[model samples]
Target: ASSSSPKMVKAIRVHELGGPEVLKWEDVDIGEPNEGQIRVRNKAIGLNFIDVYFRKGVYKASSFPFTPGMEAVGVVTAVGPGLTGRQVGDLVAYAGQPMGSYAEEQILPANKVVPVPSSVDPVVAASVLLKGMTAQFLLRRCFKVEPGHTILVHAAAGGVGSLLCQWANVLGATVIGTVSTKEKAAQAKEDGCHHVILYTEEDFVARVNELTSGNGVEVVYDSVGKDTFQGSLECLKLRGYMVSFGQSSGTPDPVPLSALAPKSLFLTRPTLMQYVVTRDELLEAAGEVFANIASGVLKVRVNHTYPLSEAAQAHADIESRKTSGSVVLVP
Candidate 1:
């Protein structure tokens, strides 16, 4: 029996970009694992704002009618010929690139997926893998958060934001988070945020200033781009790092160099793809995330979930800021 034949699978496909309604669940054809690839039967899939970006054309898609997803946990059902270190029936997970995890099964490069510990639930791994890795690079690599270093995380109750608060707290940094409501503020505090500001109720920059005693934060992790970009700068200390990672509020207007002159602030926009380009880097990041999860140091809240077919609803929820922690899709 040749492994080159295509098999039909259920997937969420986008024929054109616009809104959440574009995510159409339909049958798609998936071929067998080619050389250096493996076929995975996804048990769980991750939902991310980036998925929303692709759906809305904020991030250009490779082609129309594409399946949009980047993270998932599943069992390997077929291995490419001559591939080693992988086999059918192995539990594995992957995030970032080759982007086709919205389907019931997908063909992935052999090296991209990592082994999932039996102790971690498939849903939990699917929920945290991408967000956890993003948190890993943002806190440990991007800014090197340290003890006594005050930091502000916008959308602190979000997937990556929650992980950032937890990891930063474990690293001994003073974690300050911004949320829209008291419920989210409380959740952020439980996740190790030292201070949670209700941005909807008050001026966050002033609150951050007061919280830091006018010293300001060492870094501001701002994901709510257009809404929080400039205020993030105001919340920074001298030579602070302003990491703009997302734009749920829409892309921020261009800023001139003068914007940083006052504080001499450093700005960066990083992606998980760049951080985990190599297999070793991927292993290290995913390994650390799982280790922390196993040790109870990083607690993930799988607060929202939807069937893969209901991805549109999930996207709608995330876009409206009605969801907190991690969101997953069962396939």
Candidate 2:
């Protein structure tokens, strides 16, 4: 169908929130872009843990029958009036709100989309846009990781964790990554982890203490949430920061202010939407991610890919922790 023509596109829609079984592959109508929007024929879509959060009702949806995805790379096929700096045929990638990228074609806000560098692959851009940008803000903004700074990262082989490990290492910080399996430990080590602690075999807090000679790390990036929340705080140095970004296993329990009293620690649960609220902010973060990838400093491992129709399976794999690195849905 032509970009301007109203037509049906294959998309994954959730009529109700539940398991992977709830994601239904069906035809959805696509219309011409409205003002300040552009139609994108998606080349690749990123699968993330946040998608699972929405699917399982941990994160509420604004409405029913929603398409749940936050990142995708595609070529702009149509541009609406009042939109500038974006035109048809431009390769672009976007990661943030409104949640509708799990499709072959989607309409995206002009301000939210960023141009993907020609040197970077679309699939790689799709895979890393959200996860890499999270690492960008976590290491650069949340806490500037510097030389001699030791940090702990849970789920080191994960899409976001691997990027965090590599980026933190690049910033000259010592990275202590925690993984559930020996295989993941090895992979985490290769991804620039200075110390890989297999949490399945050992207590990460004890290992972090031993590795630092009774002292703890400067920051602990804990995405595994419920299972690692308390231990993550224990792995931190006095006055350290705990960056809880996701809940792969489950949402963390309510933490009281007294929990931070012992170590005088800092806890923050940041989201990408808040960080990239402005257009300039979106471009700046995305530019850094792309530049790092193009320069070979940041390697995006698209270790798994499924067709757009198989998004349910992709979500299942991610929830099960059966996949590592980045997973993408190819259109």
Top-TM-score candidate index = 1
How does model 2 score by TM-score? 0.97
lDDT of 1 by residue, 70-145 (tens): 9999999998888899989999999989889999999999899999998788999999999999999999998899
Question: How large is the C-alpha RMSD of every model relative to the true structure?
Answer: 0.9, 1.6
Q: Count clashes in each candidate, considering only residues at least 3 apart in sequence or on different chains.
A: 0, 0
Lowest summed lDDT window (length 10), candidate 1: 1-10
Give candidate 2 regions above 4 Å deviation: 1-5
**Residue pairs in candidate 2 whose N, alpha carbon or C atoms collide under 3 angstroms:** none
Q: List where candidate 1 sits over 4 angstroms from the true fold.
A: 1-3
Candidate 2 lDDT, tens digit per residue, 1-331? 3346675889999999899999999999878888888889999999989999999999999999999999999999888876778889999999978799999999888888888999999999999999999999999998889999999999999999999999999999999998888888888999999999988889888989999999999999989999999999888899999999888879899999999999999999998889988888888999999999999999988999999899989988888878999999997
User: Which candidate ranks first by lDDT, i.e. highest?
Assistant: 1
